[model samples]
Target: MTKAFIIPLLLWANSTYTQTSLNLKPGDTLTYSPRSDKPAWISIQSNEANMVVALFMDGKKVKEQDDSRGIKSVERLYYIPEKGRKYELKIWAKSYIERSKPVKISINESKNVDILKGQFSPDQLVEDLHTFRAIREQVNSGLYVYRSKKQIDSIYQQAETETRNSKTIFDFYKVIARLTGFEGSCHNYTDLPNHASYYLTQKSEYLPVTLKNIDGRLLQDSKGVAMPLGAEILSINGVPAKEMISRLAQYYFSDGFSMPYRETIGFDRGMLDKFYIEFGTHKNYVISYRWNGKVDEVSLPGISLENFKKLQESRHSLSFDKKLMSEKYSLTKEGEGIYRLSLRGFDFAVGQEDPAYKKFSVFLDQMIDTLEKEKIENLIVDLRGNTGGTGAVYEKVFTYLTQRPFRDSHYAYTKFNEVPMGEKLVITPLFLSNGVQDKNGLNAYLKQLYPKAVQGKYYWADDKNPSILPNEKTFKGQLYLLVDQRVASAASHLASLIKSYTNAVVIGKETVGGYYEHNGHLPLVYELPNTGIQTGFSIVHVIQDARNLPDQKKGQGIVPHIEVHQTDQEFLEQTDVYLKKVFEYMKK
Candidate 1:
């Protein structure tokens, strides 16, 4: 029952945001006892002010903010089910903008008593089957037509395969996870049997000479050219890339937002070791890809997974700018007190109880106070990296900043028609339940509409039908927000809300969250490893951010009010040129 030691570490979506070490901006750090038992609660001290932290068991609630605690004191409480491998701890933070981090948390379940206490039986299996079936129906009914059929067939096969394989549901679920790997949907995962931990790393066996879509029709004889972020499908030793693709897809499925098939097609091999490429189950050839988008084909023996990873890391160092990260992260005190704060994203390693969030919170509060204090003529509020965080925290921020009756503040939205609750699809009145002085708040009603939705629980980056704004007494001074394509989901909601303000100006790129509206999801199937099947799709289209009436076309995402974007060259320069221009305007 015992083996080696493991620790819970988080792999933050660091690529989403820029890392800036500045005065007005903040950083992060953490505090936790090393020898804690399972279900251990870790204390976090974040640098950002006015943030709220909460924990979840695979997206279900564990903890949240309280009056006694200032900000993010109780960061996350992990349930360490005794899996032999490891599961990355998923922790989310809601600040001026929302962010998330995946950390490694060790589950100590080797104790004989612990094992005795944790073991599930045939009765437990029945319960799991019942739970999974009910959830599967919910997920299946709401899919976007085509995705629905696939989900049904996938689940049916996984269940059947489990019985035939004489495998536990746990082992079966792992196989189901393999098929739906390209989805890039987060929190959509399966567990291993007997709480045996599965390693997230590519530490297991692997191939080299990664490749993307090859028309076995054309490249059957030749090894495919390499590009950035490409996948290794086959080995020089004639192993199929199916397993490899499945594993790689599993990693991205945590993404959830993008279309799976298209992503697979556009993949590039950024860095891969010199291994042979066995394209399409047959002919083998050696391959090399240069930094300048050039391909080199050769006849090589083989490469190890470790060598592939090292080569990829080396290539990443070459492709990703080093100096820019250093320069961009450097902060300069813009002015007295009112320092310009512009960083990319929220970093948990920066710590749970980070000062950056606190400083930003204080900065926001003081900004309002300063407007009243110095009788300042104008104010420029830039919200670029703000993803939606603890919805309650935003409630406080919005209440203080935009005070008035939310009678006129109604957000428009459309619901997942499958639920067929009613024709009236609206979100503004719902989220802004108790805005008016005379009313108690529509909070109770919204909760009833979607039972799973809770106040403190984190919503997706793009929650539909979010909180309503008070159109009355909005900031008259120039409130300019600079967005990029990165402005997504919750960020999109906030941007749209700000634009709805009487005098606010939204400047920057379009948002990445879907244009219509969709919610964060939980996978329905338990999965069986080795089988090419899975059940996945949204349970409900629960719209959080939508406009009046509806926009039926669901492919593209939302657009910005004052549209702006950097050229491909400008983007490569790693300059927020639009941010730069916005600053130029603020100077005036």
Candidate 2:
């Protein structure tokens, strides 16, 4: 149980979006007994940058929010105090980073309220530190692959000691975050609980300039008050930029020791806050940067979080047209006898709302029909930025592409014969029956496909390998697949299929999410009671049998056949370097 003490204080708060504050400290659970005669709305904001709040009505959890970083509210509650009805509000730190950080919850109540604030003493800090140990235990047991047992053990052992001794909770969180990244899984890692995004934009502080990693160098991509654009960063504070990047990269990993993926996110604005969480938050930064082959120093002031968020949003507004986030799939004619098929995602609901949008199966069948009818000789399938969806959605893609029966294998672990109720909440409801639309028709089929659970962890084989034959409308043409590091999950699964089975040449950078193994499909979120630290873990281990596929890496992404890398200049100019390479290869 968490060590907590409640202060008996009755305060009146106006029913405004932002007003009234409740003191909440780490390792404490505040039970607020709110009294109202009628239905009311209460706005809640926590000082914990990364915290989880569960709303309970008389001890039953009614609502829960994880990865909460902004001011949130519990709306439309029926609380009749005259009828002896009561509502309890509980809040706690969700990660080691959130430990010791005091969060002020802003509550706007329709009626005058008596709020109970939970405060934790310094003595309770070690109880919160136990969260890190629990996290380490869970990760070590369930992760598909990690560093050698000794190495992982050593890292956790060091983190445990540091967590216990560290006075600042944020520093303790950084240790565990680094440990999580050491596993080298893109899907794994602990989010900084004290991130600035958790606070109100007006109250939060942010770095003055925007950063970008180009050609492996961290550079100023936008203009700052004192720094010019395209300035290469030499150092942050007193540490060399390269050294800082290496240190921070430990908190972010993308599938099997890929530094490029970390480099790409190194430019993200969120990195600014993450940096502060690891190091301490500062008001001014002395940056040593290089521009025009000459070293320069600049003192930049930090901007308000609201302003920085706007700046980041404005950057995306500039490149609204280039992104392929819309529509599940689209096919277009780029040239005579050549086609470009952009498969952005594999979701069933992606384009289904549009009256003109065809079903995914219909779209693929018609795409093949168009290719054959138009006598298309070359096809470029753009899988760039596709993070993947239901495996059943992409299974249809392989059904039409395969020339013979295809065999795929996976190993999974579960606590029961079917998915547990709590774990099922983690899966998309649309994918509950493997994307089958009809409940009556798919009930028996789903029951058969659910993997049987065993007592510990054990390997299992896929029993169903459907015989797939290429359709008559299949286009016998030169196939090219466009991929990038953003290609993940089910998308990576699709890439592995084409590269292994078909004559298609994969182009662009290596995909994210492992080519041979991934741990997902069902993720469970657990909150440590003592500290309120929360984390999500994949309950199942998915390993695709790639023995038939040659030149596969164990815990790495799918390597492209014809590598097409982009230059820093090309990226700044918004040039399609990879597409150009594809066209050039076709010409050859």
Candidate 3:
């Protein structure tokens, strides 16, 4: 949980701002009246290491920045100010600190230039890299789960070397992206600040064509492009297709060594933005592809972000039924004796009384009644593209599929008993409680759940793991599980349980989430002191309830019994390849 600090409301009269900078002590409020209706950049410099500065517009908190471990003297915040409008700036130390030094605050008209195109000094980039590594080491429980400490140190060294010569934030992002990928946790990632991301999306330089990774080849999946559908792309610009894919793959991290997940996830619907980030803004792209057994090259102009999205919906070949993709959960009859349960995600509320949970309960009850009435013999549980959500939700789903009792995990633990770097941690609305904010609420919450938890030791979370009986009306038929690279966390946990305890025919590629274990739950995100780039990783390391099966590999996602990839024909036709394979298996 984030350490929440209370912002005291003080009545301040609007005053015409004549000075460029203002001095502020703890609990002091300074109001500035902007002369023009334009965006403004605010920077605060503090001798006090743990001070937080909050900007309020029209009595609403607009932005907040804290001095992060004194990595930099000046902490920056951005907001759009209207003419003749009053904005208030307040500074205060965290709850634990009693005294703090005065801070210097300054505001200036934001430049019209895109912040994404802005450059940082080589020293600043390297310092931010070190800060990034420090934060990860302190908070990430799975930092060395897949890669050794030496391997991680070498990755950071290489990143430092690359960051030293970096010109722009995107350039620095590439270096950081590689390190994040090497970290080998899907939950870990680095991204530009919100303001910078907003400015980037406003540009019309994103690649127009959407591509899909099929059988290790980049194939055009969008219409209106010069290349035909399913055209095998050989290169973009001067970079070979293989090399480009390899570079872009580093921008995404998957659990363990799931190479397919890293290679394929980046090229999905949001490929345009990923393409723009890896390869800089381009007005046009020179793409070479092999069409109808002939190598052809074409120069295609880039489209606006809006137009690119339009094309994805209107012309994308792999677009599924709108209703199917939008719903959280649905059950439909696939054939005379088979039923398809499409679980796009497991994001339902955990509390039984909560509307979300109640709704899911009603849906499941209705689904079971229909299945029993129809005497369905074959059931396909589609867990494709489900990144995961509430743990209780998936556990509920598992009860219907399994005959034996089970538990969600063998155990789960975090690196620390209290919030690490509480001063630098970002405070969100979720952390707010009655008048007082405690950053150590996470530890307190955990202690409440597990009274035996001790400091400097792994809390055996499942020491009292009582066996949960299967649902009384559980399905007593042949079960087929459909999963892919996108299945993760709770979804993957469910898959592991089914594979370990029951007889189910699993289809599709290996899941990106680990089969036996994963570092998940209670993710912590922090911004780099210099670059302001946000990095997040999970803190809880979990040993899942999975058996030592021959097919299940260590430090890897749950491998499907029958691994299936989308064929060229399936890609072009937008066919359900995994479902087709299931039907094929049933015919035998």
Question: Which RMSD values do the candidates have, in order?
Answer: 15.5, 9.7, 6.9
Q: Which prediction has the highest TM-score against the true structure?
A: 3
Alpha carbon lDDT of each predicted model: 0.35, 0.59, 0.72
| Cα lDDT tens digits for candidate 3, 1-588 | 222222232222432122433455544455544443456554544433234668777788887775332322344455677765677666544322212334454443343323435468999998888888888888888888888989998888888889988988888978888888787787886776532333365567767677878868999888766679888999888888888778778888878888778888777744645666777667888988998889999997877866876776665554653544677888988887999998988876744566998889788888888999999988999888888998878888888888888886777777776767765564332333223244566557656444445665456445444567788788889999998888888888888888888778999988889888888876666667676666778777888888998877777888988988777777777788888899999999
* Model 2 misplaced regions, further than 4 Å: 1-106, 109-144, 192-195, 199-205, 223-226, 316-322, 348-358, 407-410, 414-455, 458-472, 545-551
**Winning model by lDDT:** 3
Consecutive 10-residue window with the lowest summed lDDT within model 2? 421-430
Runs in model 3 with CA error above 4 Å? 1-117, 195-205, 313-315, 321-323, 429-438, 449-455, 460-466
Question: What is candidate 2's lDDT per residue for 1-588, written digit by digit as tens?
Answer: 565444344454443333346666545676655544466655444533344556776678887755332222122232344365456766554432212346665545564333222233434545554654554454333443646778877877776676666654455556666766777666664543223333223333466766666556777766444676667888877888777677666656676665555656645634545665555545777899987789989887777755765666555223622465676688889888899888887755443343333466678888888988888888888888787776666666766666755544445543333332221121222233344322232334435544454565433435643444655556567888898877877778878878777778889888776787776554444343433334455544666644455656676688888877655556567677778888889888
User: For model 1, what is the error of residue 354's alpha carbon versus the real structure, in angstroms, after optimal superposition?
Assistant: 13
Return model 2's CA RMSD, one decimal.
9.7
After the best TM-score superposition of candidate 3, give how far the Cα of residue 534 lies from its true spot, in angstroms: 1.2
Clashing pairs in model 3, backbone N/Cα/C closer than 3 A: none
How does model 2 score by TM-score?
0.72
